[model samples]
Target: MKNIPFISALFTPALIIIILSGCSRIYYAPTTQNVPLLTEQNELRIAAGISGGEEYEAVNIEVAYSPVKYVGIMLNSFHAAENSDSLFTNPVRYKGNLTEAGIGFYYPLATYYTAEVYAGYGKGTAQYPWSFDTIAPLKFDRFFVQFSAGMKRKYFEIALSDRFSYVHYTNIEEMYKIEAFSNYKYVPKNNQLYIFQEPALTMRAGLEAIKFQMQYQICIPFSGPTLGYSSYNFNLGIMLTPSVFFK
Candidate 1:
């Protein structure tokens, strides 16, 4: 929990504003990074979590399975939505979803340490309100490569992961008007590509079969001007390893 305070400080004010005032010009929202510290074959990990920050709140589902020796696969899905009904003055809403899958290699570094790398593709849509009645729907495709390493024990685990992504926005309709609501003046055009670097810290504690999990992640734009993207994300939930029960 050493990074919790620093992460909270980075986005607390902005989070408060988004929660209280609501936003109508958000461009990108981050999902939880899945880091399963698999140390052996035939291991299965499933996690369900809720993530919130910036302009959207999301539900994240992740599955990781090691079907063979030194090989693993992962699937992830996310759905996010938010509205401004509480504000009463600015009635806006945002919605988005994404799904991705990847296959990679994993290996044990020592008796208690493991590492993995994965590359995947995903697609989703984000709807941002331009006015009380007008909504702009944008679609995007994503390609990403991620690396993770961590230590695993019977009661607790900690991991660090970094994901590099290329996002291309498509089907942009009436996106230019976002400048009127948000700080940026330039809007992303159709098929415009943006690169991002996302780093996350993940922790799990409890029993070996099931554990409480929490993660904090930050997104950094690498190639494009800062559009209205969620700067950070926080997730909390539970993780299950059914194989532990069989053993």
Candidate 2:
């Protein structure tokens, strides 16, 4: 929410990268095929893929993998109408989404299906205003953890796949608990926050296409929550994996 303005600032940067990557889309409408995402298994190697689409005039990044089979990760990040930048006069620049990193266990199902015990924390928006952010000083002072159960289909025995998170983030604004976003030298002792409080469910589905020996992923992001100021968000873009690996 507070990051919307900052996220919008990335458009210029993303545009430059898109131009440099030689992958550009006019985006007149939407072109995401409701396609199957799983690839057949064939090797004892690692694979990675990414995808993104455009919504709220912002781009999203999706990442997935088979780094070893038993170990994998998925990530997502976005913003609300709230300002992503501190200097934005509008305070509602644009929606921003970015999935930094997530680690989970991937279970291969039916040689075509995969299940995940996925728990992740990514920034997102409210389907409806809970007035939590406006409630008090506790809004920005706390963080949360969320969990999801998902299914994915293998893609042509490669790094491509599709998955959905039926469960979404909740308990958006523990504003009464937000005593830190302020510049106080001393911190409070009471802290209460929930990953979700349930006004509307934030369901998300994604399709991933891995190409170039799993060097990059093309992902399309779509979400339409039936509650709030930003009822639904649709965005698309690509995610690139740095050659360097940590851990």
Candidate 3:
């Protein structure tokens, strides 16, 4: 599936802003959640939610179906916007979308505890922020592995998850014009491989059909050629899930 454009597109402009603002960060870890809804035979689920922060925002939708007792197939899509600027420049905004599909397995570890694992891949496109004339030629391919454990109570549930991701950006030279970074001495040296890890804690409350969700996440970059990249990204979001499962 295809969709993850806005977050990818924001890279160039965000890089410029960060560099000009006296920092040298070139990577961002998109906000993602891991909530496994394992259904009974022939059951399906549909969920949507909105999430945001000072520099980025997103709308997400997901569909899942369980053909067996503990395994599920899932599909998801997102539209996101990212904005930033140097202290002296007006803010520049970038918008794009992404979609992914994956499979997950869940099992109970204890009376109130469960564990889950899932993986997915997706692609997206966005226009270069300099102008909308040409679509960004950057080729982005992403792969992720996630693990989660949670406890469920009568009306509330708490979950903790870790997501490991690898992303490769191809044909990066297309946007590597020297003029673009003339104002800054340091520029991204490698565009081929980026690695990130995110750990999140989530809580949900309410009945089966309607529930409220909130999450806090921290993103850590493991590998990159960089100077002063944000080691800890403070992130947060909220969501509401309706009709979690259809029997």
Candidate 4:
């Protein structure tokens, strides 16, 4: 739990994908507003991501587009939480890969809502006892698809997100499978199990020279219901983004 503060330092704030076109008016059509849609006209960008706070660490890969009206994809590799016979049982060094492919569309003058759809695929493994035993590790497969409607504003957008995930392995790859509360995702590498191992939320904010995409959020089970953490998955990293902020 001490890592919470360390992760807090990295937790700069909400990620803002600010559309700096600087239109004086708040309500205007994208055609007139000169919006930064993910169309062919956008500058293509590559991105990398790092995540995990007192729980798990994850790496993400994505392609950022400014030219397209609203369309892009994100690929991710989520590491399972490490097991813990001790405070940290060599923390489960598990990896699951996922890909998100979707589109953003709207009416000629509509704002604050866009049609969205996406699909994903992932796989990972761990020892029967959440250890890297020489014996064959247990494996799991996952995939999900959702037809969602997303809100769109210059500052932020909150959407009603609904997603369903599946986990497989007869011997139970995740400890959760062995626990009382049954979660959709495997136990990850950590013995700790919680529902919505990876909950889904959608929001984005912009910083001085960077933009953030709030892909999903998790209420830190360790903390009170109020004191929870969110996961900002699958977005651009500062090191690789182009310097279009000032221009």
Candidate 5:
């Protein structure tokens, strides 16, 4: 009976330490991958939506146009942010944005199927709470190649896409000081490189000109440094093809 009290006393501190150490900070959040099913010239696709998972949310905008036969161009932007309730004594917050542009070729595989390939470059900045009183900002560059194929019907569409990306972190400020927090040990170091394979499934349903869209995506680490990042993403939004309405 006397030993019971001694065991509890020793275990209490260890349990607290474990709980505190388990808290992790997110350094990377994957954005929604845009998939536009273009089949011919003069086709345009515009989409705006909200995407999020686990610890963050984002506003996403995408535009794709086919100006010439089998030639397509696209632009995408994402603004993401997260603010968590206080952990221990301090709150954690993050703000970031990314922009990307790509050019690609698309072709119709069958009556309703289309296939496309694109390569793009992206740049982004992330600002997050590094310490109880300090926030650190980081910049990163990414290059990606994506392949997509889908079926488009009169009132519905479905697509599957896989994107491979290489990300490099730069302009890291105060990375050396991150070691002060034990929980943040998983954060990536300066000049780190990481390769990610992201695959997504997208669906849309509604009228011929406008439709409700949803996407589910997963991010997998392919190589290089690994850290705490959002691995899954869900997006809900609307897609518009103005040309269809006019036709």
Candidate 6:
């Protein structure tokens, strides 16, 4: 029987094919989960975390500010690299890097809920195992709407967020024309779009300004076809929400 590593590793080729094709935007889309809750004007919060999956490892960081009670702004970034240990074949090392940046708007929903909408763009590069040293580019844009409900207490807080994403790719044909991945199988059609929906639940426990956090995210299967992403992932990290100024 094949081990789980072999099964999971098989997807790499397909992912490599899709990434080089440039039609699917799934490869460069950020997989981080953001839950923003701003209760007062001039409040500032920063979060950082690392997440891992079968094929990739990612680092995420974000900063948010609530200038007024009813409005907030946030910026976030992500960087991911392929995991060489997950590869199935020897001497076939899959190498890739992806980076993303996003800006978002947040609105308070009642007393315990917050809603956010964000737009993001990213770029990626991959070197296929068969391609030796040549690298190919992948470019994409994305946007999402998210909602969160949480309870904030003196000692701890619990939050849950649902995020929906739409991803679009550009210059797919140009990527395929690159010399490195020119001979790969199942070449993809260019200029494609995809959608994804993810929901995450989080728990944070700590003092008034600093907290330890753990979160679980599931990529719902209904939105669109996912060629390069996993169905579920988890993140563990910390958040700092120190009050900046008095209103």
Where in model 6 is the C-alpha error above 4 Å?
A: 1-30, 86-132, 174-189, 221-226, 244-247
Q: Estimate each model's TM-score.
A: 0.84, 0.35, 0.73, 0.46, 0.86, 0.71
**Candidates 3 and 5: which is better by TM-score?**
5
Better of 5 and 6 by TM-score: 5
Each candidate: what lDDT? Answer: 0.83, 0.31, 0.60, 0.37, 0.84, 0.62
Per-residue lDDT of model 1, residues 182-223, tens digit only: 443445656568888999999999999999999999999989
Kindly give the number of clashing pairs for every candidate.
0, 51, 6, 20, 0, 0
Model 3: lDDT to the true structure:
0.60
Task: Compose the digit string of candidate 4's lDDT tens values, residues 207-230.
Answer: 423456544443223211211123
Lowest-sum lDDT 10-residue window in model 5? 83-92
The numbered model that scores best in TM-score is 5
Instruction: Summarize candidate 6's per-residue lDDT along 1-247 as a digit string, tens digits.
Output: 6588898798978886665444212353236676756666687888888876655567777777776665666776666666544333224444445455555566666765555565555555544333555445555666666677777676687887887777665555654565234332323235556777788898888987788878888876444443455566677788888673343
Number of the candidate with higher TM-score, 1 or 4: 1
lDDT by residue (tens digit), candidate 2, 78-131 = 333332233321332322233344555655555545544444444333322222
Error of 1 at 187 (Å): 3.2
Worst ten in a row by lDDT for model 6 = 179-188
Which residue ranges in model 3 land beyond 4 Å of their true spot? 1-27, 37-39, 85-92, 131-137, 182-191, 227-247
| Candidate 1, poorest ten consecutive residues by summed lDDT | 177-186
Best by lDDT: 5
Model 2 residue runs over 4 Å out of place are: 1-55, 79-99, 122-231, 235-247
> Cα deviation of 196 in candidate 1 (Å)?
0.8
Better of 5 and 6 by lDDT: 5
